[model samples]
Target: MLVLDLVATLVFGVSGGLTAVRLRLDVVGVLALATLTGLGGGWIRDVLIGVTPPAGLADWRYLTAPMIGGLVTFFLHPQLDRINATISVVDAFGLGLFSVAGALKAVEHGLGPLPSTLLGLTTGVGGGVLRDIVIGVIPTVLRKGELYAIPAVAGAGVAVLGSRLELTTPVVAAVAASVTTGWRLLALWRGWTAPEPVRAAAAP
Candidate 1:
């Protein structure tokens, strides 16, 4: 879990730092955004699950991954800029990994399937949402016709079902992460979109 968590953190941190660089934020702001994007979801999950002090606060690695990400982006963003689309793809991978990991952890902690799944979704999107809100942008998960949160829920559901069926954690997580990442990547490739509220036609 720790390994998966840290891997997810690094990718998310890079994405966050890239965003900050694209927006021309200062060094401190870039670092701050990267840290929040890397650890915010885990912190929120830990707090809600009664893990006080949060891993983000207690673990040096959790804090350091984002810092390194920020530094890398700060120094290398000009080259990184050529591959913005690639960053989004990596962000999708992080989303998948985190959702499965979070759901499995919640289940381990005795959370019910429903709560575990919901918490998993939160864990997947919370960091990106935080990063977006801090930068005054609408969260991608909440955007109209966005295809983000549903993939998270689907991935979390797989983990929840696997747990209920007594599957091993590693196997279940692999399946769930694959489902989420594949779905997200396919959606991006095919321009698949979530539903948006329809507006009735107005009288002329």
Candidate 2:
């Protein structure tokens, strides 16, 4: 679970750094965004579950992973810019990893399955939401036609269910992550979208 969380943080940091580069943000902006994207979700999860100080704040590796991502993007943005699709694919994987890890952690903290699932979804997408808001864009989770949150919810739910069933941690994590990553990738490749709300007709 620790390994999965760290890898997810690094992956999200990369995603955030790439977004900053695309926006032509300065070095500080890039680093800040990376750190927020990498650690925001976990921090939120920890705080909500009464874990003070947050693990990311306590662990040097957690802090370093985002720094590395930010520095790498700062130096290699030109090359990275050409691979937006690949980055999206990787971001999906990160989403899956975070979701399962968060759900499992919540379960360990004695949260009920439903709460664990919600926290897992939040852990998967909270950072991205913060990043988008900081950059003055609507969050993907809230945007029309974006299929971002559903897969996360599904993944978290699966992890929670697996835990309830007493499945091994590794097996639960793997299956839950696979479900999220696969669903997200398929959505991207096939242009799948969440349904939009209907607009009322205008008065003449």
Candidate 3:
């Protein structure tokens, strides 16, 4: 769980740093955004579950992961840009890992299955949502027709169900994460989207 969390943090942090670079933010902005994006979801989860101070804040490794990600993006963004497509895939992987990790933690804390699933979904998207809000943009998960949150919810549900069924944690996490990452990658490849409300034609 620790390893998975660290990897997810690094991936999300790199993504945030890349966004900062694209927006021409300074070094401080890049590092700040990276740390926020990496740790925001976990912090929110811990607080909601009544855990004091949050695990990310208490752990040096969690801080280090995002810091390294920020530095890597700061120095290597040019090379990173050439692999934008790959980064999206990796981001999906991070989303999956986070969803499972969050849901399991919630279950460990005695949250009901439904609440755990919701928390898991929140964990997957919360960091990105916060990052977007900080940068003055609408979050992708909340944007019309985006398919991001649905996959997360589905994965979280699966994780909760697995826990309820007494499945081993490793197996449950693997399956849940694969479901999320696969669904997201499929949506990206196939242009799948959530349903959008139809707009009436403009009045003449």
Candidate 4:
């Protein structure tokens, strides 16, 4: 579980660092943003689950991964920018992973299915929300045109259901995460857009 957490943190950390780089932040700012984006969701989860002092803070490795991510981006932004096309793929994979991990943890902590699903989504997107808000941009998960949260919800739902069904942990997590990552990738490839709210006609 810690390994999965660290992996997701590293992935999110890279995205956060890349955002900092895009905004021309110095190394300190980059690391700060990376730390927040990498561990924000897990922290939110731990708090909701009544676990004081989240894993990211308690476990040195969790913090270390994000710092490494920041350093990589800080020094190698040019190489990363050159391969920018793969960035979204990495981000989507992390989203799927986090969602599954979140849902499983919630279940382990005795949360019901509905709450677990929601927590899964939160764990999947909360870090990015923190990153975006800190950077003064609308969070992608809250934006209408993006299919981000939908896939996350689907993945979390699967994990929750699988847990209830007594499936093996590894199987449930892998399948659920794959569904999420696959759906998100398909949306990206196909330019799929979530439906937007229609404005009501003005009264005459």
Best by the TM-score measure: 3
lDDT of 4 by residue, 56-136 (tens): 789899889988988999999899888776878888888999998998999999999999999999899998999999999
Which numbered prediction scores highest in lDDT against the true structure?
Answer: 3
Off by over 4 Å in 3: 198-204
Instruction: Give the C-alpha miss distance for residue 168 in model 1, angstroms.
Output: 1.2
Q: List, residue by residue over 67-98, the lDDT tens digit for candidate 1.
A: 88888888998887888788879878889998
Q: CA lDDT, every prediction?
A: 0.88, 0.89, 0.91, 0.90
**Can you rank all candidates by lDDT, best first?**
3, 4, 2, 1
Clash count, predicted structure 1: 0
lDDT of 2 by residue, 71-174 (tens): 88899888887887888887899999988888999999999999999999989999988899899998878976778899999999999999999999899899
Tell how far residue 170 is off in model 2, in angstroms: 1.5
Badly placed stretches (over 4 Å) of model 1 are 1-4, 200-204
Model 3 over residues 1-204: C-alpha lDDT tens digits? Answer: 678778889989998899899999999989988999998888899999999899888999999898799999999999998998988898899999998889999999999999999999889998888899999999978987668999999999999999999999899999999999999999999989997658865777
| Candidate 4 minimal-lDDT segment of 10 residues | 195-204
State TM-scores per candidate. Answer: 0.92, 0.93, 0.94, 0.93
Residue 137, model 2, lDDT: 96
Give the better candidate number (1 or 4) by TM-score: 4
CA lDDT of 183 in candidate 3?
99
Candidate 2 TM-score over all chains jointly = 0.93
